[model samples]
Target: MAQRLGALDLLILLPDPELGILRPAPGFRQTLPGGSTWTELLGRCAGGGEFRATIAYPDVQRLSPADVFITPDGAVLMLIGGQPRVRASELAGAAGLVLALLRSEAREDAASASARASGDVTRRATALASSLDRARADLAKNAAALRDALSDAARLNDELRLLNETLEQRVRNEIAERAKAEDALRQAQKMEAIGRLTGGVAHDFNNLLSPIIGSLDMLVRRGVGGEREQRLVDGALQSAERAKILVQRLLAFARRQPLQPGAVDLNQLVRDMAQLIASTMGATVEVRVELPDDLPPVTADANQLEMALLNLAVNARDAMPGGGMLKISAEPEQVIPGKSHRLRAGRYVRLSVSDTGVGMDEATLSRAIEPFFSTKGVGSGTGLGLSMVHGLALQQNGDLAITSREGAGTTVDLWLPVSGAPAGANDGPGNAAEPLRGSGTALLVDDEDLVRMCTAQMLMELGYRVEEANSAEAALRLLDAGLCPDLLVTDHIMPRMSGAQLARLLTSRIQDLPVLIVSGYAEADGVPAGIPRLCKPFRQAELAASIAALMPTTAIRRRKDVRQ
Candidate 1:
C-alpha cells in the first residue's frame, strides 16, 4: 500500500492503555516525533471526521507527515512523506484496504503474520509499479498531441493575419482611387466656370482696347509728329498691340477665339522653326528636331501652333538654368475607341517637345494648364502660355498631354487630328497685297461712340465715306430710309439687334451687298455663316484687307445708287 500511494513509509496504529499513547501495530515502527501521542495528534485535527493533517516532524528528514488517516473502530492508517496519491474523496477506499491488511495480520501468531505481511506487500508493490509505468506512457502521448494542436493553431493564426493585411491594403487603394476621381471631376468643373467668366471679361476688354489701338495706329501711320513725338507714339502703339495680344490669349483660354484650322505640314513647320528656336534658347541649349520623313499632315491653326511651339521652347530654356537638350519630335498615333478619355478616337499626329531640364512635381503639373497659374516669380511671366496652347488644342478638336517628374525632365505632347487634305490648303493669297483704296459709302455701325469714331477714322483713311450708327437698329433704320450704302461694316454684339441679324436682313433686301462682321470674340451661334469676319482691335490695313477680300474688285457699287 505504501508503494501504491508513493509514500516512504506506512503504519497501522492502535491505542495502548499501559503506555497511555498511540502505538504502531506489532512488527511496525513509529516514524512520528518522539513526544507525539495519538491523543495530541487527534486533538490538532479535532471535529473533522476522516481528516488528514500535515504534522511537522523536525527530527526526521521527511518534509511532511504526508497523510494521517484515522480509520473507524479505533484503528489508524498513516502515510509518511510524498504527496497523497489518492484524492480526499478516495482516501476512504484506501483506508478500507489498509484496515483489511491490518486485520489479516492481527489474526495470526507474531512470526507467521510478519512473514505473510511481507509476501503480500511484495506482490502488491509489483502490481502498483506496473500500473504507474502504463499511466506515464499515456501521459507522454497526450502531451505530444497537445503540442501539435498548438502548433497548427499558431500557423492558422499567421495565415489569417496575412489575409487581413492584404484586404486592408486593397481597401486603402480603392479609397485612394475614388478620391482621385472626385478630384478630377472638381477640377474640370472649376476650369469650365473659369472659361466662361474669362470669355466675357476678354470681350469687354477688347472693346475697350479697340479705340486706343485704332487712334494710336492712325497717329503712327500718318507720321503726324516730329521724330521724338513719333517715337513716343510708336511706343504707345506697341504697348496697345501688346494689350491686344494679351486679350487674344485670354480669348484663347476661354476657347472663344476663332481658329483657322488648315492642313499643316508639321514636319516642315518644326524644321523651319529650328533655327529660330535655337537662337531664342541661346547657345547653352542644344536644339534637335526629330521628325519622320513620311509624317502625315495634321489639321491645326498654323500661327497658333507656331506660338505654342515657341512657348514650349521658351519654357524649356527657362527650366534649364545651366544648359540642356531641347528636342522637337512628331509621330503618328491611332487612338482606339474607349482607350482614352481626353482624346477622340481617330488618327492623330503627336507633336512633342522634350527638355532635359528641371521638371515639375505632381502639384505643379496639375495646375500647369490653368490660366495665370505660373511657377515663375511675379512680373516674370503672364502665366498664359500653357493655357493658351491647351485652349487652342481643344478648339481644334485636339488634346494636350504633359508628363513630368521632379529632377528628371518634361515632355509635352500636342495631339492634332490627322488631315486628309495635303498641307497648305488654306495658305491664303501668298504675299501681302497693297492696302485697299476704296471710294464709296461704308455704313459703319457700333454701339460704343469711341469705337464708332475710331472705325469712322479708319474708313476715312481708307478713302471711304463713313456713315455711323450707334446700334444695329439705327443701321437698319438708315437702310430703310432710302439710304443705299456701297458696303456694310458692323460690330456683331449690339443691343436690340445683332450684326448677324442686320446682315441677314440687308442681304435679303439688297443682293450682292458686301458685308463684314467685326467682333472681339467668336460667337458662333450669333454670327451668320458665309459673311467675312474681321476680329476687333484691327488697324486700318486689316480693315482694308477685309474689304478687299469681301469685294475682291477695287471698284464696288450697289445695285441702287441712292444716298442719305
Candidate 2:
C-alpha cells in the first residue's frame, strides 16, 4: 500500500545523512555513475537494468523499499516514498513510444546509406523514394507525441514551483503569529505586575488608616470621656506609629528612603529577632539563631535592617502554617561583579532566614519579591513584606536572594556590604515629652491644603507663629518679600520645583537659616547633604525634636498650656 507521504508530488533521491540530509530536491533525476549508494544504484537499475533492492532510511536505522523504472530518454523513477501521483503504466507507454522513434531513425539511416551505394536507375530510385516518404510521415507523428509529453512536464513543473512558494509563505506566517503571541504575553505580565503593586499599597495604607480614624473619631465625640478618652488617643498614636512604618517600607521600595548607613553587627541583630520570631510564629514553629559574634559588620541602616529581619520572620511564619523550624544565621561573604544586581564586588555580611515548610515552586518564587505578590489569601497578609525587605537590602548596597523547593523549605539571603568601622548604638524609643516651643516665626510648605493646615497647626502647638506656602516657588516668594522665618520645612515631592531644588536656592540666599525636608521618601542623592530630615505622618514630639535640631537660633518659649 502506498502511504503517499510528504507535500511533494515527486522527490529525487540524493544520498545523504538524516537530520543533516533533510534537504529539498527537484523532481528531475540526474543519472550518476554506477555506485553502491542507494541513489546511484536506483539510477542504474531504472536505466532498463533488472535489479530491485531495499535500502536504509537515510542515516536512520530502518529499511525502505524502492521500485525503479527507466524512461525512454534514459531517466530513472525512484518510487521510494511510494507517492501515488505518478503512474507507472502511463510513463511506461511514453517510454515505449520513444523507443519506437529511436528504432525508426536507425532504420531510415541504413536505408539512405544503401540507396546511395547502389546504381539503381529508375526502378530503385522510385522504390527508395516511396520508402523514404513513408518513414518521414511516421517521424512526424512521433515528433507531435514528444511535443505533448514536453508540454505536460512543463505544467507539472509550474505546479511544483507554486507549491514550494506557498510552503515558504506558510512558514513565515507561523513565525509572525508566534512573535505576536509572545508580545501579548509580555504585556499581560506587565499589567498584572502593576495591579499587584497598586493593590498591596492600598491595602497597607488602608489598614493603618482604619485604626487611626476609628480611635480619633471616638476621642473627638462630645467631651473628654476621662480614661476611656485617653485610651482612644493612645490607640490613635499607636496606629499612626504603625502607619509611619508602612510609609517607610513604601519609601524603601522606591529607593527614596534615607538610610543612616553605618556599620551594623549582624550577629546581634539576628539574636534580637529570635524572640520576636518565636513569639510571633507561635509554638508550632521553632526559632533558631546561628550567628558568630566574630562575623564582620555590614554598612546598613540599623532600623531598616531590623525591619527587614522582622519581615522575613513574618514571611517564614506564613509559610509554615502547619509548623516548622525557622533558622537565622550570619556569615561573611565576598561577591563578584554582576553576581548580584544590588551588590557590587565587596566583602559582605550574609544574613539569612531559612524555614522548613511547604516551599514555593519556580513560578511563585520568581515573583516572590515583586510588590503585592503573596501566596497568602487576602486579609491574611500584605504581599509587600518580602518586597520591602528586598528594597531595604538594595538601598543599603546589598542584595536579597531566595532559595526554595516545593514541600521542602525556603531561605532568604541578605547580602550586605561590610564596612571597616565598628557598629554603633541605635536610637531607642524614649518617653514622650512636650513639644518644643520657640518664639520666632516658622515657614511650612506642602502641596496638599489639608496637609499644610495640619503641619501648620503642629508648628503652632510648638509655640512658633507658622506661615504657609502651597508650593516651593510660593515659599521663595515669602522669603523674597523679606518675611524671614527661623526655619524652612517643606515637602520633598512637589510640582514645578521640588524641595531639594528649593532648599539649594534658599541656602544660597538665607545664609544661616535652617531647612527641614519632610516626605514619605526623598531621592537618596537628590536631597542636599547634612540637612536634618523628618519623615511624614509625624507627631508633635517628633516635630519638636526635628525643629530643635535644625533651628537652634529660635529662642525657647515653653508653652504652659500644652497637655501632658
Candidate 3:
C-alpha cells in the first residue's frame, strides 16, 4: 500500500484526483499563500479539458499533492502519490482500483503511525535510562568523595591529638627542669654561705695562735739549753706547729688560702713522688704513674698538688687493706663555656688518680669532698684531705670530680686550667733560705694588742726601731703627724678600711715606701698584688726572712727622714 521514500518518510500508493478530473481539487476561487492554489488550477483544466497544473502551499508543508479518483459509489478518493503524463480519460476505469489502493494506503498509514509512536516511546525510554545511569554514577562519586573526606578528617584528628599530647609532655619536662635548676641554685648559695663562715672562724683562730707561736720561737732562739727546758720547749713548739697545720687545713677547705700559682710540670712532679707514694701506700700496694710527655703544664700550687696526691694514695691504701694498684695519670681536657659546672670553659690538664680497691657507696661519695666527712678510724685521719684538694682545685679556677661504685674502684679527677707556657722542672726548694737580720725604722700595724706586742718584740730583738699603730686609722694619724719609718708593716684584715687600703693611701703620701703585709688566711679581694705577704702563726725566723726580703725593695727611701 506504501513505498519507502527515505529513513523517516513514505510514499502512499494512489493516483492524483486532479489528474482524473483533468483539474485541480475544487476550492472557493482562492489562491495559496505562496501564489498558486487548487482553485486556479481547476479553472485552467475545467470541462474535462486535457491539462495539468502545479499548486504550491509553501506555509502548509503537510498539505501534500493529493491523487484523486471517483469510486463505484460516486465518492471521490484522495491520496498522496505522483503519476507522469496521464490523460484525464484514463482515470474513468481506474477509479475503483484507485479507491481500493487508497483504502490499502489508509490501513498502511495507520500501521506506520503505530510503529512511529512505538519508536518515539522507545527513544524516550532510552534517554531516561541513560539519565538514570549518569545520576547513579554521580551518586557513587559523591559517596566516594564523602568517604575520602571522612578519612582525611580522621587523620587530622589523630595528628592533633598526638600534637596536644606532645605539648603537654614538653610542658611537664620544662617545669621539672626549672624546679631542678632552682633547687641547685639554692644549694649552691647555702654552701657559699657556709664556706664564708668557716673561713672567718679559721682566720680568727690563726690570729689567736700567731702571738703564742711568735713568743715560743723567740724563747727557743734565746737559747734554752737545759735538757728539761729544751724538751718542754720542743714539745710546746711541736704542739703549736700541729695547731698551725690544723688551721691551714681549715683554710684550704674553705678555699681561702692564698696560693702561689706557677707553671708546674705535672708529669715530673708525679714521677718524683712515685717512690714516696709507693712506700707510704705500703709494700703490698703497687703504684703506677702514667705521665705522658705531651701533657701541658697546669697553673697551680705544686706543693698542694703533691699533698692531694698523697691524700688520695692514703685513701686508696686504706680501702684495700691488703693491697691494690694506684694508677696516676695526666692528660688534657676540653670544657665548654657556661655548660661546664663549677668551672670556666678552657683547656685543662686533668690529673687523675685511679685506685683498684673497695669503693665508696653513693651516700659516702656524695659527701666525699665535704670537710670532716671521713671513713677512717678515729686518730687515723683528719678528714680534711679530700676537702683540701677540692678547695685547692676551686682556688685555681678548676674543678674536682670523683666517680666510684660500691664494689668497683674509685677515680678522682683534678681538672686544672692549663698554663700557656710549657712545663718546667721547678722542683727542689730553691737554696735553703735562712733568717736574715736587718736594722731599720719599722712601722708595725695591728688591731690586736697581744699579736702586735709579740711581733714588735721580735722586731726589736732583731735590732730594728719599731713604731706601733693600733689601727689603720691611728696609723694614718701617725703619718699625718709626720712619723715616717723605713719600713711599713701592716696586718691585712683590720677594722674600717683594710691594711692594704691604708698602705695604698700611705704609699701615695710617701713615694717608694716599702709595705709588708701580715695575714692569717684572708681573701685577696682588697689586698693589692705584687706586695709581699707573711702568713700569721709565724716564727721570728720567718718574720725576719720576710722583712729582709722586703727591705731591698725601697725599705729606706730617705734614711735621714726616719722617726723611730
TM-score of each: 0.70, 0.62, 0.71
For all the candidates, what are their Cα RMSDs to the real structure?
11.2, 14.4, 25.5
- How well does candidate 1 match the true structure, expressed as C-alpha RMSD? 11.2
Query: Which 10-residue window of candidate 1 scores lowest in summed lDDT?
Result: 86-95
Model 1 per-residue lDDT tens digits across residues 263-291: 99998999898999999999899999999
Pairs with steric clashes in candidate 1 = none
lDDT of 2 by residue, 231-321 (tens): 8777766766666666666656655566778777777777776777689989999888888869987788888888888888888888888
Tens-digit lDDT track of model 3 for 1-564: 112211111111223566553322222122333445555644443333333344443344534454443333434333333442232333434434334444544554565566577766565545445544654565456445645665697799999999999999999999999999997788677667767887888899888999889888877887767888988887898999998987787888899986788889888888899889988998888888888888888998888888888988888888888788989988898888887767788899888899889899978986787777789889998888888888888899998899999878999999999998666543434433544445567899999899999999988987778899999999988877877777888898988978899888877777668888988875779788868888888988788777766666332445444332
Residue 86 C-alpha lDDT in model 2: 44
lDDT of 2 at 105: 48
Determine the backbone clash count of candidate 2.
0
Judge candidate 1 at residue 369 and give its lDDT. 92
Clashes of each: 0, 0, 5
TM-score, prediction 3: 0.71
